[model samples]
Target: MNLENTLAFAKRQDEADELRDFRNQFLFPKHEDQNFIYLCGNSLGLQPKVTKEVMSHQLDNWANYAVEGWFDGNEPWMFYHKELKKLIAPIVGALPVEVCPMNTLTVNLHLLMVSFYQPKGKRFKIIMEGGAFPSDQYAIESQVKFHGYEPDQAIIEVFPRKGEDVLRTEDIIIKIKENKDEIALVLFGGINYYTGQWYDMEAITKAGHEIGAIVGWDLAHAAGNVPVKLHDWGVDFACWCSYKYQNSGPGGISGIFVHEKHFSNQDLNRFAGWWGYQENKRFKMEKGFIPESGADGWQVSCTQVMPMALYHASLQIFNQVGSFEKLRNKSIALTNYLEFTINEVNKSLGTNQYTIITPQDPASRGAQLSIIASQNGKQIFDGLMENHILGDWREPNVIRLSPVPLYNSFEDVFLTGQALLAITKKILKSS
Candidate 1:
């Protein structure tokens, strides 16, 4: 697609889009009777129209059945996760039995680390990407300390090359090889939050396995943004939040994946609770904890009906589109077009005022473009907000614009480009 900066070009692209109707399913925020062009799905997703109806139906069930809703409803609360795991499995590329909807991302990470982060005397270090999301840093730091190891000595961070903006696959693999004997766990975000770099999961998993270590991923940004085969990649464990790309509501239910190979391993320690006990034998409530088969065994508490209901509303939307493979094609195009638009802004100004820190290669990133404006970055971001264009700002002058394929259109990108040009010009002229 030869790109154009005109509004007509953008409208034509939107007119031909197959997924255009799906955009109507979401309720976008508005100011002064005009809808904002929302490009913040990487931070928070728009609410789906079906979410309210689903929530109301669940509320009705609560009013009618109350305590009996656990077993009496059309979708019983006791068995609801099975239905969700079926929907969630394909998103992360795993068997239905290998995935579970449970606690939030960091909470799930902590629970999984309790089982996967076992360390002996020598091979006790955890290797990860430098400048990970703060939650991951805090979680890993506490886990190592719980095992009686100093943070500095127990955690090895793989950084990008001196002049580069993202980590190299070979450099990451070399880091694993360098710490082969002492590396107990290899944990990384599937797509880095700040740089928007998608790591080679299969290569990293193979590297970790070669060195006799467990590999895991925190797919906070990648789960619904890109396609990944955790099962085929031999990734041992993974977790993600559904609120961002999945469009379940804010603080939505999180998901975890433990490969089928680990399901029957009784030696893996977990913080057991009654809900994880064998379902058929649960009411008997007798002696020791005998976990249910598959990933359901990791459950720590009873079902959360409302959150699952909200999640179910969005999962049905994904089910309508079928899979991430369907969305990936459009994702690459939207991100590329946005990148091109940013470059055009700099070209028009005859200077490199806007620099995209995200990798230009579509394969190395998802829908996000992390932009750093050389002048008045914060002012430019605020201008977009005032103009009914909703992107998000990170600390230290990074403005992230994520053009989600499911809801965002090419016209949105074009209009955003126009807004950026006008804002930059106005800010520079006034200064």
Candidate 2:
């Protein structure tokens, strides 16, 4: 997979791409006089052309049917979430019954914890990656406190070795084994947000289960960026937001997956709402909760119709593409090209100006390459933005660029490299 640093080579690769047409379906933001090279799909995705139309249709139903919309219309409000389940099931690799489009990511995390994070006797500890997304850190800490345990005593965070940027699989497994006795749950992000490391979920699941711990994932970065097999991996439960790689609008609907093994477990508790009641008897207004079977049982409220509609429009694109395998193949190549181009920049400069923190192995990471800028990183990031080379910058000088398979072209990656090289040169010359 040799890569060239020329725009012509990138255009040639784009010309040969079968998924090239997908870029047209998304609406890109304009910068100066042309479309900005958007590589921030790791943060927020571009809107689909169909999203507006689908949203209008739902709005029209609301205008015409009002409360009756719940039971009437083409896609009845009552069962709309079910339609999303069918489209999303394959994307996350789960049976339709095991998945549901529901509450936002953190809310679902808390709700699922009530059922899965049962601590008893000496087993009250939770193991997670050190430096997990702040939301997860907050959620885990709050859950520990709510259960009457101190955060410092109840949580174990596994970190990379002092000099390494990514966690080794052996280190993570060893930590789980060492804390096997006191662990009540092992919750981790499927992909670490800052480093872009995709953990070995199957191995983690097995290790946690050996210790009699429930394992779950916060897959905000992993869901559509990389291929996941939650059902096959026997993951206890998982949740994800659709706004990132899934291309749903900002604050889009989130999804949850609960393994079928937990469906019949009567001891598992849930904070229920009317929508989560058994569908047939829901209108009966019966007392005592009879949760709708499967993951839907965890729902605490009715669907957020507008957001779900936006998400559905994006899922349609995924459906048209057929499978995540094709998207994943292109993702690997695109990220690889970006990595190669960045390395070439460093070599040409005769110094390591950019250090990629993301794992080099395609299997160990997704589309994102988190690069640590060696000098004037913030100024370089500003230059990229001014040039409409849209990548995100984190504090302390890391720039994350993700070339999405569905909407981003190889040319996008090519131009991004050019911007980085140019910006770095200007910064060094002035210094």
TM-score of candidate 1 against the unseen true structure: 0.99
lDDT of 2 at 316: 96
**On residues 84-203, what C-alpha lDDT tens digit does candidate 1 reach at each position?**
998998899999999999889999999999999999979999999998999999999999999999999999999999989899999999999999999999999999999899988999
lDDT at position 279, candidate 2: 86
**Local distance difference test scores for all models:** 0.93, 0.94
Q: How accurate locally is residue 250 in candidate 1, as Cα lDDT from 0 to 100?
A: 95
- Clashes in predicted model 1: 0
Model 2 per-residue lDDT tens digits across residues 1-431: 67899999999999999899999999999977788999999999999999999999999999999999988999999899999999999999999999999879999999999999999999999999999999999999999999999999999999999999999988999999998899999999999999999999999999999989999999999999999999999999999999999988888889999999999999997888988899899889989999999998888898889889999999999999997899999999899999999998998899999999999999999999999988899999999999898899887778999999999999999888888898899989998
RMSD of 1: 0.8
